[model samples]
Target: PFPSVALVGYTNAGKSTLFNRLTGAEVMAKDLLFATLDTTQRTIRLPQGRPAIIADTVGFVSDLPHELVESFRATLEEVGEADLILHVRDIASPDSAAQAKDVEAVLEQIPTPDGKTRRILEVWNKIDLLEPETRETVVGQAERLAREGTAAAVSAWTGEGIEALRDTIASLIDDDPETQLTVEPHRGDLLAWLYANGRVTGRETDDDGRVHLTVRLHPAALGRLERLYPDVID
Candidate 1:
């Protein structure tokens, strides 16, 4: 199955801009709230060249009408079905932190399979709206989180860091496959990751410095493996 990602955030967080940048869709981006009342989705190529569906969800508002909630019920359920959730935020907004908390509150209501916490990645977007010094700080914080594989920073309007964001989202999807892949004997790093992230059912090393492995990887780690080291399998 194709992995899916859902974009969710407080209203006017530049999600439409990010959505357009990611999927090449022309969702009308407006400064006004509730501009995107309906959810939109498109298939986009992840950095690893795998295709995944990215959903642009209706933005959340502070005082949403009950009818508005009813209208977006399907979108919220899509969020629940997503393999990854990108919590897009207007990082330059004055109330951004609280806005993030509110978005988090909504995500909390979405039940997950087996009640596991839904995998989420914070998209710290709209850094272009910040002052130079502040932009540096915001991007720096995002890079730190990127190291942990949890967040990304970008100015979706300007296209800055969009590639990295795509890579990060690919790095965060969760899935499992009973599959076979070969690792070169020289690539101990790949072997370690396979062992750490998946259950290895079979292995054999050939004299030509190649190691064959049969493993089951839950998707996120498998994606990282494929993204970072495709040649090992090839």
Candidate 2:
């Protein structure tokens, strides 16, 4: 299956803008805080030719209201279920570090199913708003962090460094090995499940209705399938 990525950050940090820029979708990307109250997801192609699901979530804030957190459980859960978390930051903002702390505080409260920490990549966004010298310095720093597989700098508005961000995400997703399986035909439910949970690249049905599938699945999804249909796996 295609990997999932969740975009999370402080309010007005340009997550929506980056989301739109990356997915080419027109979901509202306003300058106002909390403009995106619901989660929006779109299919995007990673730099390495694999597709992925990318979600834009409501913005975070310091001391996030308990009521809102309770109401937005589903949206927040997307962050927990994501294969990768992109912590979008307004690098041009003076309070960027403090805002990042606020985001980190909220992330800690989310539940991860496997009791394992999710991989996070810092996205230092809005470099287009920086001055020439400052942009150079910030971009250089981000590039160094990216080399270590930790961060990327981009201008959601101007498309700066976006390709590099895509590449980074693809590299991270590809770090896992995918599984291959052939299953019996006429199992509509199983076929549908495979399409929904993984990237199905090939499918064929022979005269007897047997199905052969080539799917690219994350390790977790592969494990789930293995448990469910151990006999079918080959």
Per-residue lDDT tens digits for candidate 1, residues 89-166, read 999999999999888877766667675567889999988899999999989989999988788999999999999988
User: Residue 40 of candidate 1: its Cα lDDT?
Assistant: 92
Looking at model 2, how many pairs of residues clash? 4
Cα lDDT, model 2, residue 146: 98
Evaluate all candidate structures by whole-model CA lDDT and list the values in order: 0.81, 0.87
Q: Which runs in model 2 stand beyond 4 Å of their true positions?
A: 178-234
Residue 72 lDDT, candidate 2, scale 0-100: 89
TM-score of each: 0.73, 0.78
Model 1 TM: 0.73
Model 2 Cα RMSD, 1 decimal: 5.1
Query: What lDDT does model 2 reach?
Result: 0.87
**Which runs in model 1 stand beyond 4 Å of their true positions?**
63-68, 174-234
